[model samples]
Target: MEATLPAVAEELLREIKKAFQETSHVPDELLLALKFIFGSSAVAALDLVDQHSVSRVVSPSGRAVYQVLGSSGKVYTCYAACHFCTCPAFAFSVLRKNDSLLCKHLLAVYLSQAAGVCQELSVSDQHLASILLEEEEG
Candidate 1:
């Protein structure tokens, strides 16, 4: 049976709270960002489950792809201009922040990409890519 939206949402919230409670080295900026994202009902909706997957794939142009499997058993694909996550949290994060990182959806994607288990994982986002580039340059 599929999980209801509220159930998934509540589960996600527990995970976020547990993550926050267990972290000792979290940066102030990250903590603030977490509070801002998880603090809101809309954003909180994204953290409702613990089961998911992430994978990476190479593009024709030689770029990495990222895929996310949401707790609701939905898949989201994001590659450059074609980014989509199965969870509403991903969209909520983007819509809520003009310039912020460390959202739960992004975290999920990053974890999935890092784990190398996503399908057709060749996905990228300009916004995320630019951040990586900036970090490299800095």
Candidate 2:
């Protein structure tokens, strides 16, 4: 039972991403399903997507970084490939407490990518390094 839970969730997420890719917008039924699966995080992620807050920053060497401007007006660094996010909710609810699978910002990155709506930017590796080193204010 425990093992099947993650598999089920993964399948659902795949379906959601496919729907977004196919239609460029989530249908009402899919929205309801997302709400049931992700709760308020789903709503917040959708809002971020609507605001066009997700960005894909790529360096000349082909390294890519993802960032999301959260609802709280803070820019969060997200490594979607690694399932990591620099957000308080990710630290508290995902890592420390294990109560959630992802932070809203991370989810937003995934949704934005699936919809092919993320703001893409190309920069030098030095600039990418600067972005990675910048401190986040609480």
Candidate 3:
């Protein structure tokens, strides 16, 4: 079956977000990633994280998801590799214009992974459920 880029991208995005949210305490790797995205001080990045704005989430299948919590309490999945975000800023400002700009959420995930903060979570029946569901639904 042909891989739907969005789904695959979502899977990757989920994992990255999950790592940040669920990983054992925030490590230097994650902080480093934030620095890259938010700049050397990393104050803004920490602020976002401290506020629980950016986090890792669990999908219905039990897979870890990378998500950014909006001010409105809307959680958006993020795909750093594809520079995609399921948020209004992305959908309206970027997608509507057919632009290829990366949102802050995407940048955070990318920098976190690149800095070695996030990791590929181990697959489990509970977590794998989401992955399977995605395959079935998509």
TM-score of each: 0.37, 0.87, 0.43
RMSD of each: 13.2, 3.8, 9.3
What is the C-alpha local distance difference test score of each model? Answer: 0.45, 0.83, 0.53
Best by lDDT: 2
- Which candidate do you rate higher for TM-score, 2 or 3? 2
Using lDDT as the yardstick, the better of models 1 and 3 is 3
* Candidate 3 residue lDDT tens string, 9-45: 3454345466656764556665555454334324533
Worst 10 residues of 3 by lDDT: 1-10
Error of 2 at 15 (Å): 1.7
Show model 2 residue runs off by greater than 4 Å: 1-5, 135-138
TM value for model 1 = 0.37
Cand. 1 Cα-lDDT: 0.45
86: Cα error in model 2, Å: 0.6
Candidate 2 lDDT by residue in tens digits, 1-138: 112226655676778779877876678887787778777898999899999999999999998889898888888888877788888899999899998878899888877877788999899999988888883433
Which candidate has the top score in TM-score? 2
Clashing pairs in 2: none
- Best-to-worst order by TM-score is 2, 3, 1
> Candidate 1, residues 80-136: lDDT per residue as tens digits?
323344345555664465333333544555333333323453444664475345434
